[model samples]
Every structure is written in C-alpha cells, then in structure tokens.
Target: MNANPKILLYILMISALGINTPLSIVGIISQIAEYFNTSIAISGLYVSSFTFTIAICGLFIPVLFSKYNRKRTFVSILTVFAISNIAIIFTKSIYIASFFRILSAIFYPAFISIALTVCEEIAPKGEEQDYITKILLGISIGSIVGLPITTGLGTIFNYQVAMSWIFAINLLSLILIIIFFPKIKGKAKSYEMPFSSLKSKEFLLATIGIMMMPIGASIVYNYQPYFLQVVSHVYTYKLSIFLFIYGLFSIFGTWLGGKLIAKRDKATILIFQLICGGVFVLLYLFANYLIPVLILILIFGILDGMGYNLIQYIESSVIPDSPELANGVFLSILNGGIALGIAIGGFLVDGFGIMSIFIFGALFLLLAFIILYYIIGIMKMPLKYS
Candidate 1:
C-alpha cells in the first residue's frame, strides 16, 4: 500500500519526539536531585536507566517482533510509552521515576526499528538514503527543538509539567498514528534470522566503531547541565538558551552528514572523529571562558548531529541484506554506548571534576578513529557509495 509522504513524515517526527521525551529531562536533573534529596550522580540515573533499558531491549526486539504487523505494533508501543510518561508525572522519588523511564524505554528500540523498516520499504530506488535522512531529521529535531523546550518548561515550572508536555506530544502522535499511518504487513515467517547479519567481520568492526562515538560524546553530553552550571557559570535560565542554540546547529550537522556521506563515507567520518576529538580537548582547555565555550558548543553540536546519521548509514551499508536487524543492532549499541558514557562520566564527576569528562571524551573519539581507520585502510573493506 502506498503511504502519503507528508503524513508518514509527521508520524515519524511525532514518534521520535515521544521516544526522546525522557532525554528532555536532562536539563532538570539538578532539580531532581534536590527534590529527591539525592546526589547529582544518582539523579543522572533517570537518563542512564532509560538508555540502558533501550540498549538491552534493542538487541532482540526486532527479531522477536519481525513478523508482527508494523502499524499495529507501533501503535501499541506508543500507547505503553504514553502510559509510562504519565506515571512519571506522579512519581515522588527519583528512583521511581527512573523505573518508569526504563519501562517506557522497553519499546523504544522496536519502535525505531519498525520506523526505519517502513521508510526503506516505501523509498523509491536510489532515493533510500534521502528518505533515511528525512526520518533522521525527525530524530534531530526531537533533540534540537523538543529537548530545549521541555527543558525550559521544567526549569520554569517543574519536572511534572515537563513530563506532561511530553505526554501531550505523545498522545498527539498516537492519534496521528491511528489515523494516518498505513498498514504495512510484516515479514514472512521464513525470513532470515536477524543474527545472520552479525557474522560479517566488517559489520562487527563498523558496529564497534560506531558504538564508541556515542560513548565518547555522551560522556560530556549526559552531564552538560551540571557542567555548564559549575564550570561555565551559566545560570539555569540561560542553560536552555545555550542548549537551544547547540540544537539549532545540530540540525545543520544532521543535514550535512546526509550530504557528505554520499560522496566519501570513510573520509568524512574519519575527519569528523578527529576534529571532534580536538574539539573536546579544546572544551576542556577553555572551560572557564564563555566566548570559547559558546564557539565550541556550536561546533560540537554539528559534530554531534553528524555522528548520529553517519553511524547509521555506515551500519546499514555494512549489512545491506538485513536492514531491520542492522538498524536494531545499531540502536542497541548506540544506547549501550550512551549508558557506558554516563557511567564513566559519573565516575569522573565524583573523582576528578566535571571538566575532566571532556578529556576522556576526546580519548574515546581517538579510539573510534583508530578502529574506523583499521576497517577501511588495513582491512581493505570495499566502500559502497550510494
């Protein structure tokens, strides 16, 4: 069945907003800590727990649900997601809030995987990447626009209000999905096993390389609110503005990644990692200066957006025969990396200081650069230019 392109885009964008609702809480984590009478590190678990649940669930959700009706499954998942967000609105403790976050995250990977599959199915020949890029724009916009706005709400009113905002958006998405999303049939029972794609050495190496990028980036990003408060002396009101600007540039970066990856995938990603590492190091060196910090935020935001799409492009390229499985593994590893980054960042915050996380971020990117180089350079894997 042919789906209306505009309606499909709306569905994808709204679903992404719902998926990213938990992340919008990052800016108010300090308030959460104070509310629960806990440490900042513990308060950070609200983000980490959600990401970690997605990581584990992503590994198997696609494979388990591959034969289910895509439209029905997606609608059902969003319903549960809405319920989880509403539960968070009433929770009085950080730990309870985190538990509901985890419950909501259980369906996230499957939702993303199905969305990617639907995009691929409808994309005309030779235009798959463009379609993929459009869907990823939904993700970028959710981060760039949704995140800062919800963060501002939480800052102005309270966390419950922020969560209510998320619930409202998600509810709208559910209504749209029920009305406009096309009914796409699932794969046949005899479809190839998802794990079949993991047997390739190139795919495995590419996954590892992509995983490192998030771990590196999240080390700094997960604690950005606290970092800005302590190191840059950015007030809570101003923090949302800075995040909004960072997100604006990030949208550009996402678009740029789609454009550049088509020409020179390996070279583009390699240079991005190298420059990203340098930018992190620079962030550490100039942490105390507002001018340099603003510049770096713009640069890092772009790099951050580029990383999201480039990594997905590479992952799918390595295992072209299994897009659903590849996308699932990509989400799993990506969020797994984020969880790891948060853990590592928490350690640094407790021991060295928040500024130290940037240095460690640079180190992780260096490692990603090395593995990526090894795959394209030493292993001589043929680059597929779409």
Candidate 2:
C-alpha cells in the first residue's frame, strides 16, 4: 500500500483541526474576557489550562494506549473534539466553557501522536519529513486561515460564532478522516518506553534547547492582541488581518525548515532561535511604528512557524522507533512552554506592561540560544553539519 497524497491530506487536515481547536481563541482572548465579564488575567487562564491539560496528557496517553488502533483513535478523539465545540455553545458560564476546553484538550495528544507516527508509517521511507511537512502546513493554516477567520468572526459576531467556525472546521475534518484515512485497525507491535529517554543527558539538553524559544514565542502569542493594540493601535478586524499575514508567512518558514531539516537539523534550529530572538528584540524597538511592527511580526511569525517542524523533527529523531514517546514529549514540553509563558505573561502584563512580554520573550530566546549552542558544542550532538 503506497502512501497516497489524498489520504495524507486527510490526515494532515484532521490533525490540524484537533490541534487548532484550542487555538480558535488566539486573537479573541481579550474579547472573551469582556464577554465572560472577567479580567484579562483571568481570561489568560484559558490558554494555560488548555495547554497544561495537553502537557499532562502528552506524558501518559502515548504509554497508556500504545497498541490501540491509530485510525480509530484519531476518529474517536475528533468526535469528542467536535462534540465539545458544539457543547461549548450551550454553556452559560466560563466554568462550563472551560470544562469543555479541558475535555477537548485530552484528545489533543491522541491526534498529534497518531499523526506523527502515521506520517512516518505511510511515508516512502526516508521521506517522512516530507509527509510531516504536509501536516505542519496544516498547522500553519490555523494561524493563516483558521485563526484569522475565527477571530474575524469573533470581531464581527461574537465568540460563540467564532467557536461555530471552529465547529465547522472540526466537522469537515471528522468527515474527511473517516472517508479518506487508511483503515489500519489493530495495534502497532513492539512498543517500547525506555527509561533512558528520561535519563539521557543529551536528549534532555536537546529538548530544553528548543523549549526556550517556544516559551518566548508563547509570551508574545498569548498576548499579541494586547501588544498590537498598545503598539500599533490596531483593533479587532484590522488586527486579525495582521495576524493573517503573520500566519501566511509562517508557511514559507515551515517549507524552509522542512528543507533545512534535510541538512542541518540542530544548526538550523539554533540559527532560527538567534534570528527569532533578535526579532523579539526588534518588536520592542519598533513597537511604535505600524509598518515596521507588522513586518517584525511577519519575521517573528515565520521563525515561530519553522519552530513547529524543528521541534517535532528533533524529538522524533531522539527516539525514532517510539513515536508515542517522542511525540508525547514533544507535545508535553512545547505546551508546557506555552503554559508557562501564559502564566508568567499574566503577571508581566498586570504588573509591568504589555511590552514587557516581548522583552521577556527576547531574553528567554537569547538565553536559550546561548545554552543550546553550549550544549551542542560540548555534547557534540550530530544534528547534520554546517
């Protein structure tokens, strides 16, 4: 059974839907706060709780159901995600809405873990990254297409309507998965969870290597709207357009990262960190200028975009045979970064200023880059050459 492109598209789209459900609120966080009659600090908890739930699930879901049917699990989880989005519309309070978010989060690892492993499984050996790129492209769509559109809807109608937009996307993904996905029933044999995965010093360093940039990225991400408002004075619909541009360029970055991964995996990642770190610094400098700020956002978005592929590629390479463990840790730490950033950003925004988030993000990235370079230099980890 050769890997079919059409089937791969189905897998990628479905995986994107699973992941993007939580992201539906990206640009609309502030709006959600107003709608829920809460403070921005409290509203920030949505992203934190959502990511933290995924972090917790990422550590365990892979081990618990290593043998389960990947296709069925994918479909089942999307079904739950779809149901949750629909149910969220009926919830009368933030508490109920948050419950649905947490509930949907549990299924995130199921799709992501399955998607990565399946991409590897269905690829024509050694071309797995090519398939992985297709999925990452789908993720980029969330920023470019899904998020902007959903946020736009929120700007126009309300958050409920924005959620309905997500519901629509999830529905499309669910239908496509069942129709086009290959039926690989039954479990994968030879599942292995090496305790050495935790004990490996090099692996831990590499994991932390990519982790810092994401922490910084999330600091900006979770509070971008607030920053844009303070910096460029763009609001609502106009803001979503800039975000769309930010997401659109990220696709190019994804393509670039995919190509570079073929050559200098770790080096390419480190270079991106340095570039993104600088971009974060520029965000602070150019905050007062509209055109320059938007351009910087584009550069930041592209680097951030490349980062998704780089992180997953490195994590999977660390434990090639164990897809769940690899992807599980990938999702865990990545979301852990987002959770931590949002948590800390709440304090920064409330105490310091909106601009402080970017400064903090920049510092985090620079520090991470320094540490990553030292680790790679000392450990002499072979990630493809210069």
TM for every model, in the order presented, reads: 0.89, 0.87
Compose the digit string of candidate 1's lDDT tens values, residues 1-386. Answer: 77776568657867876677666676688767766778988987666677778888887777677788888988898898888887778878777777778887888887887787788777777666666777777777876677777777887887778778889988988888899888888888524664655777887888888888999999988787788888778886588678778888988898888788877777897899899999999988888898898899789999998887777877777777666766778788878887889889989999998888889999999999999899887987766563
The Cα RMSD in angstroms, rounded to one decimal, for candidate 1 relative to the true structure is 2.8
Model 2: how far residue 183 lies from native, Å:
1.7
Cα deviation in Å at residue 157, candidate 2? 3.2
Distance from true location, Cα of 125 in model 1, Å: 2.8
RMSD values, in order shown: 2.8, 3.0
Error of 1 at 300 (Å): 1.1
Q: Give the candidate number with the greatest TM-score.
A: 1
lDDT of candidate 2 over 1-386, digit per residue (tens): 44585567556665674457567576688878878888887787874677789888997777665677766877888898888888877676788889989998887876777776777677776777777777777766764676667777888898888888788878887887787776664454636667786668767877877788678888987798788886679997687677677777888888778888877776786787778878878888878888888888888777877888888877776666577778888888888887788778889999998989888998888877877787666767655223
Overall local distance difference test of candidate 2: 0.77
Q: Where does model 2 exceed 4 Å of error?
A: 2-6, 28-47, 185-192, 233-237, 286-290, 350-355, 384-386
Q: Global CA lDDT of candidate 1, please?
A: 0.80
* Model 2 / residue 79 / CA error / Å: 1.8
